[model samples]
Target chain A: MLSFSEENYLKAIYHIEQLQTEGASTNTVAKKMQTKASSVTDMLQKLADKRLVVYKKYQGALLSAKGKKIAASVIRKHRLWETFLVNKLNFSWDEVHDIAEQLEHIKSEKLIDSLDAFLEFPRVDPHGDPIPDKDGNMTKQKKVMLSTLKENQQSKLVTIKDSSDNFLRYLDKKQIAIGNTIKVIAIEPFDKSIQVQIEGREFMITEEVAENLLVEIPSLTLPKVKRTN
Target chain B: MLSFSEENYLKAIYHIEQLQTEGASTNTVAKKMQTKASSVTDMLQKLADKRLVVYKKYQGALLSAKGKKIAASVIRKHRLWETFLVNKLNFSWDEVHDIAEQLEHIKSEKLIDSLDAFLEFPRVDPHGDPIPDKDGNMTKQKKVMLSTLKENQQSKLVTIKDSSDNFLRYLDKKQIAIGNTIKVIAIEPFDKSIQVQIEGREFMITEEVAENLLVEIPSLTLPKVKRTN
Candidate 1:
């Protein structure tokens, strides 16, 4: 049986590897886990002993097949639990992540499988992040950062990369949310700040903020000519 | 935040104290926790330090007020998750305990409270065990052991103290289940076995088996003097 700490380490490693597909460095993992590099080194040895990770000192770690299986299973359970919390338990998007984090470590295949059936196998979590399937496959969807949109281009908010309560609150404060239609009206190249319209009201957003917002081009019904709407 | 093992220890101590009331002995806790007496002593000291358990070396351990609150909160989360699994996720009653055990340790009060709301504030879990309220108070209902029923007395199965899959399979083999009306036709004094009729079928059940079953007698209905069919 995996200890709770071990499961947490694996989860952290799996997520860190997402950004750097070559795998995750010990320093990066230590920083992400808020632990000392020595502590991460000790855990990496243990995980390597357990055949859950491929470790090379000062290089990085990659999940082995067994490790990936566990990671995917954890992801599946986490997203399903989040859906249950939000859709049935009446939890807001902000309230589900922590609870789901704890729940994802439960070692019951039957329970998670049953939950998958219960939620009708939701393809995404409450935060619009794609949920991995039972086989650990996440649906590949096309998305671009809102900052990349040209002036006067129309887009729809498609998803969020983070689901923390603070992140969700920030989105809420900006009146931006999943399914919200947005039109990029102007971009200031000096600071890379963007001005976007929501419900006919214009709002100024920072470059960093725009990069975090994921959007998809709205399908056009007529020939497009760039015009200020 | 309590580790899962710490939460389990607290819950075990709480239950052991419940049976004894005065306190719980190391041996008793060991038996309940399936650990050695030394391990229980070590855990007891840790719990005492945390102000969650009141402990005396040889005498035993009792839940402090703080510990009681924690235990009740864990119970509430457990039952609520069980209800969610069965009602929303379509899990079998026999498959929810181990999953709920892990879910009970989740450290989000809002998540649990929201789940309680989502489950419509269920009064009991799938096993008919009373779910503690948000305040950690359980509704104490009067129940009688099936073994104590008099001859020709009729009652309905309300709950069971044991939730093992083995026990459930055994009950299924005997055609006994929650909500099934039963009539005790005879009590064999020689071995104190119960002969009961379930859904018009008669079977003899041992005293030990009957003792584990919880039954309720409705005041509005008179006891059937004899088996109807």
Candidate 2:
């Protein structure tokens, strides 16, 4: 089994790789992990030796299949735990992250499976992030930034790009939550702040905050055509 | 915050101190941790430096007040998690221990407090071990070994002195559970094996098994005679 730190490295690299085409650079990973680049290089080399990552001297590193699997498993555990804390334990979304981080490292398939069952197999965490299934599969939802929505167009909150505690608390203060319907009322040309309607209340959010909120437009499904045989 | 390994050491030392009046010896801690004596000594010294324990030259170590509080908190977390697994997730008692071991190290006062509330403040875990309160207080139940009960005496199973998987599985096979009413029907004079009645089923159990089963004979609540005021 990998150490907790090793598992953390793999998870960091996986997220970095998702945003870029090339392998995750040591500096990028260090920035994400809030650690020294030199330390990242050392860890990359160790992971390479373990065949968990493909590390090139100057080009950075990428997770091997084995490493990716482990990383996804950790993420799965984390999202599921977060869901449990919020849905079952009455914890708010902003407060579940740190606790879930520790729970993600618990190594027990049976325990996690049992928890999944108890939580009724949630598809998304309280943050609206899609949870990875047992086989390391995540259902990618088609979502766009809230700021990108046209004026008068409505969408549902799918997930948020930023799950930082500050951002989450800000959202909470606005009474925003996953699955809430949001509509763009207008945008300020000077500062790019958007006036939006959530549930019947209208509010203005800064461009940065709007950009962090991912929203999905509802599909217009006409009545199914019935053909006579 | 203490590392998971450090917390484990404190818990082990705490258990050892309970069994013996003196401080825990390095050899005993080593046996509990399944590590080398030298490593235990090194860890003990580190703990001493942190003021979590008092370590002597060769005489072993004892937890300080701060250390004891931390140990009790960890125990509280462990037993609470075990209770959650069994009560909420439908996990068998024998399957909850290892999972709880990992969960006990999670660092979050709010999360644990929420869990305690969700579980309705259970007094004892599924294994019949009492859970420590938030203030590090444990209620010591009046209990004795089943083997010590005389013939024709009836008692209730309170807890198990041994929790090894083998022993728990054996108990499961025999349909034994905590809080079951056990009656000592007879005892073999030659071998010290006792015939026990549990839930209308009569069976023979060896003295070794009986010794591990802690039981309590209920005190009769006699009716008080009314007196003139």
Best by DockQ: 2
In the range A1-229, model 1's lDDT, one tens digit per residue, is: 8887788888888888776678888888899888998999999999999999999888778999888877877888888988988887777788777778778888888777877887788898877778888788888567888888887787878787666578789987877778788888889989999899976778898888888888875554533677798
Alpha-carbon TM-score of each model against the true structure: 0.89, 0.92
C-alpha displacement of B121 in model 2, angstroms? 0.7
Model 1: how far residue B107 lies from native, Å: 1.4
Best by TM-score: 2
lDDT of 1 by residue, B1-229 (tens): 8877788888887777666577889988889889899998999999999999888878888899999988888888888988988888787777788888877887887887777887788898888888999778998767788887887778888889777899877987887878889888899989999899998999898898899888895454555455688
Q: Give the fraction of true interface contacts kept by model 1.
A: 0.87
lDDT of 2 by residue, B1-229 (tens): 6888999999999999987879999999999999999999999999999999999979999999999999999999999999998899888888889989989999999989999999999999998989999999999788889998877778899999999999999999999999999988899999999999998999999999999999985454423446699
Using Cα atoms, each model's DockQ against the true complex is: 0.69, 0.73
Q: What is the overall TM-score of model 2 with all chains considered together?
A: 0.92
Each candidate's number of clashing pairs is: 0, 0
* TM-score of decoy 1: 0.89
For residue B146, model 1's alpha carbon misses the true position, in angstroms, by 2.0
Residue B125, candidate 2: C-alpha displacement in angstroms: 0.8
